[model samples]
Target chain A: MADRPVSDIELKAPKGDWRDAHVELRKGTFSNASLPKDLIALGLPNPRKWQPTDLDWQLPPDWKGILLRGMRERLAKYRSFRLFMDVCVRCGACADKCHFYLGSGDPKNMPFARAELIRSVYRRYFTLSGRLFRSLADARDLTEDVVKEWFYYFYQCTECRRCSVYCPFGIDTAEITIIVRELLSLIGVSTHWVTEPAANCYRVGNHLGIAPHAFKDALDFARDELRELTGLDIEIPISRKGAEILFVMPSADYFATPHYYTLLGYMMLFHEIGLDFTVSAYASEGGNFGLFHSNDLMKRLNAKIYEEAKRLGVRWILGGECGHMWRVLHQYMDTMNGPADFLEVPVSPLTGTRFANAASTKMVHICEFTADLLYHEKIKLDPSRNDEYVVTYHDSCNPSRAMGLLEEPRYVLKRACNHFHEMPAKTIREYTFCCGSGAGLGNDENMEMRLRGGFPRAQAVRHVREAHGVNLLACICAIDKATLPTLMDYWVPGVQVAGVHELLGNALVMKGAKERTTNLRGEPLAKETANA
Target chain B: MATPATVEERWLAAAATVSGGLIAAHTLTERDPFRNPIGHVLRRNLAALVREFFGAMDEAAIDAAFGEIMALRSIQDLSVERAVGFVFRLRGIVREEAPQMQPAEAEARIDRLAISAFTQYLACRERLADLKLNEQLRALGVARRRTAHRGGAPA
Candidate 1:
């Protein structure tokens, strides 16, 4: 019965990355002058000033027994929190795979080491022997300083869940990261990147901060792509009732440069199949970075989809190939959003086999839907259109491991391209690596961060391309668009990346469509500027 | 854009059409779904299937067809692990009835779905898999914390 919950802690600014401190440590900086004198020399705020030397710290009534205990109890029951507390085997194999590790060479960046930061605290607070006997697990004092460190490194992690694939015991650090972040949020600590998007999502339904007008224009443009490419009067139908499906996707697709082409693929394919689908402006975002940070935020972000789904009276939800977005649906949507008996299993029209768990509004990956359509004789092909070069595939991290969508895209690629070649070493299925930019690290503010993160993946791609003379990279994620080519230019110089949808669109020979304007090399030409 | 809808409504409509239409036509010397009870579950589900397969089905198609699947009660709520078999079987049924489907197209499509389904399937199977993975991670964290307390035990 812990009494007196600590209320009103000050929220400090972000420490950015522990890597900088880690680099300094490697240089033998901290331990060397950490002698109390160094604090005065460095002009750091002195503990002597902050500590309450005059009186004893008393617990506030607001922070007492039931409320705080109830919070802990509730958190302990959350899926990610519970799973985070119950699993993990500290193997360091995922060390080199982490971008922060490669970028900073900090021991703390190693996925296992980063997890160790919070796991140690959890042990003392939650474990049996830890609470009474602080003998072995030296649970550090839960001071304001500890809170500071938690805010710093926690945001540094993107929660990609890539490490879990290689763990012999299959420990997912991402889940732990989520739980820790949630705990931090409980103390009212906030990060600009995570909380800002979550707040924006609550207001505008997108992570990129696009207004409803811009959103409408983007949707119109996606529709225009369909009309131009298919030469059919296909509508980027919005809110049409009695519609068969709702293609709820990332608004980034509605706004970003290269990834928008993937949206074009969706528009073209829908026209070809005469499919009745519409985008819901209310819940259009597919990326759930908030999920990677906090379960509460995840629940908040996911709530919009259900609200929109009920409002529109639609059956199923289909996802784009964004990493965290798929992660939220595949991993946590059911646990959070349920009573979904209205939606039928997403049975592939081509094979009639149900997609994922059909019982709960079976969600399908865009790539899986596209590939399956091709597999069950649903879509015709014009593979000759992709004759310009040999193509290789890069499995987007979440779709590859978290969602199990690696093979579907490859199958579609093989049929759509005459010269398809698999990238070598840890490519495809579970062994696949990340796009170096999954989980929101792909933005311009994080450009240098993206390049630094994409190095190892770039090497893997280069090896395969050089060995096989492959020049084109077909990836199933938007994150790859921003990071891959930059990485390729630096490491693999000549290789390029494109979305699987873009490739399929290239191979799709629309019967009544006008002459194709797309180049054979398959790179998107300069954007047509509509008089802004 | 259209107003939003829940995964439940999406699936419920599809399930109702499939179950309702199947029930109605089960007795009639029936007509194929596309023509008969136009709103039949099979046809509606097929519409969803086609939309999902062809990668063009918009938000409305999602509500009509796979919305039920999106909203289907998770295996976590139920005592059995039937979503996997049901979904796969449904895939088979749609594959049988769908027209204009080509073998070469099916081959390519399955190839794509194989990786995504295995890696990112929204089916409860992958969720459970992720849970298992999460369990493995936390356990290791507990063990490490425990060992560190006992004077940092050797690996």
Candidate 2:
């Protein structure tokens, strides 16, 4: 019977103030369950072989009590959590700001609704008004079902904070998501994707769990790739004492593609300028998954960078390209682990450009350093080397909205590539869409959700692809470089993705370098053919 | 039962119904404002698909509309019954709105559209899987190149 039920369909919009729209809890909607082994690997205390979608989540006997108590503890510990739970007037300004809502059309994915998922639960448990008038106050009891809802929707958020940018009261869903996750973690109810990385970052000082010697070997491989491309052997000192600057990068940059090429670019730039920098094997990773989980976990993983910096006796720290890594360094690190009065303020060695913005943390972004280097005419560049790529810059969420790093990456992209195009005015800079794979959501099992979350971003990229024939999507975030290529291939075919450093690697004119036939990925340069 | 008077009302009613279901899937757990860009596209695509299936436009137009829907649906975690169910939603709309429609002919058209839409959804799904594989391969390729360079390094 192909008589698909389109009859008797009465379509009516929710009435009487959209904020009072009926909240439904339809079962079987969320089924992408987290695995038990992943939880165990992340060092979570949960029974093995128990999945989230199962009728029995194998949660502790007093799970409901644990969650309520945990929420109460967090509310006291974190003022932002208490303030965010109380301050929302349901104004609805932030409803559409979430890329998840824009891409998925799921009203629950809306930032306001997503926050309400937790706020409603908060009211039922904590506030007297909520207990007095449950329905009117939009409060619901914390039940087994409510815990399941938390596990499903809280993990869906990339915690990009685009909503906070537009919120009148500056209510941050990212903070809400983080606190909810912390409460979930107290009950041993968290996604394997996030916990596994947090576990690895804690134990190995990197997310990929690469060992010390293996990390060195990967850097050695990158150094050799640089030597092959530039014909100059650049020394990459690892964990060397008395190095003036301690350089830390996302471990993905060492082992992963497109990212590795950018790693090579860093080597080339440091080699060209003869900057005194040392990358530590211990402080190998810059991206922190702990930020996605809890504030204390973030500080635990982030402490290694400063630890290595002080151990190496470096004057200052220079961080490589990443999204949340910068967010942690800029906003959280100094507050959590600092009085890094042990380290001096960072100044660009080539141009003597003091990073006034990073004076407190004493960590400078590589883009800021490179942009300053280019501004002072320190490095020789040939923009035509990247002529094949009509580039567009993607402002990563943490970098732009969190740290206000809007212009530095574009400054580097403009000088490194011949043709640069900006996406729609609304989509670029402060209003940038996420790559849909940030905050430890870059797992293969959840590709469908990731793609949905990534659609608004892919749509903006598709805009530039059609308008300017932009083949290259350049960004400063390592996650963007890793994930956007896949997003481009799926949504807008023919668009390539790379980091700004990869473009710089292609365009940098190294001294005594052999005649080049290829770009960073070992593809032949389009300009080389024309020049010949 | 009587259908709407004008072609515009008929199509608009059909679109409103189809998009309303698509929007409801997102609100399975909670409800908020029922407006979004995805809903707008779903509405437009439904109208365009109705036009194309009835020979007002070519198959390319149907394909384009289905392509957009497939892209949006692919990212959603929906089962086969749910994912391709929207394509066949037009069958009831045709039964309601189309004047003097033969049930057999309408079923055939709806079946054909479902098959085409399913094929499009599969293609998008396949591309996502392949891109993931390609990403792994690309990382391997970069690693291999790095290894080769490391070996060729002057001692």
Give the candidate number with the greatest lDDT. Answer: 2
How large is the interface RMSD of each prediction? 26.6, 6.3
TM-score of each: 0.63, 0.89
Candidate 1 fnat reads 0.00
Kindly list the per-residue Cα lDDT of model 2 for residues A1-532, writing each as its tens digit: 1132233334344434433433332232232334665556555655355556577777888888888888889899889999999999979888777877777666677788888888988998799989999868888877777777777777779999988888999888899999998888777776666777777777788888889988887877777777777788989999999988999888878888778888888988899899888998889899998898788788888888888888889999998999999999888888899868999988887788888888889999999899999989999998888888899988999999899999989999999988999988777788888888887777776676777778778878877888899888888887887788888888788998888898998999988888778898878798677878
True contacts kept of each: 0.00, 0.35
Please provide, for model 2 over B1-155, each residue's C-alpha lDDT reduced to its tens digit, 9 standing for 90 to 100: 43322332334333332212443432222222222445555656766776666665466777888887777776565555666775666655667767576889878877877877888888887887787687776655455665565575322
CAPRI verdict (incorrect, acceptable, medium, high) for model 2: acceptable
Q: Which stretches of candidate 2 lie over 4 Å from their true place?
A: A1-49, B1-36, B43-51, B54-61, B77-79, B89-112, B138-141, B147-155
Q: After superposition, how far is residue A178 of candidate 2 from its true place, in Å?
A: 0.5
**For candidate 2, what is the DockQ?**
0.30
Residues A357-444, candidate 1: write the lDDT tens digits. Answer: 5467466777778877887777887776676658988877777777777678888889888887775555456766555555544433
Question: In candidate 1 chain B, where is summed lDDT lowest over 10 consecutive residues?
Answer: B19-28
Model-by-model DockQ, in order: 0.01, 0.30
TM-score, candidate number 1: 0.63
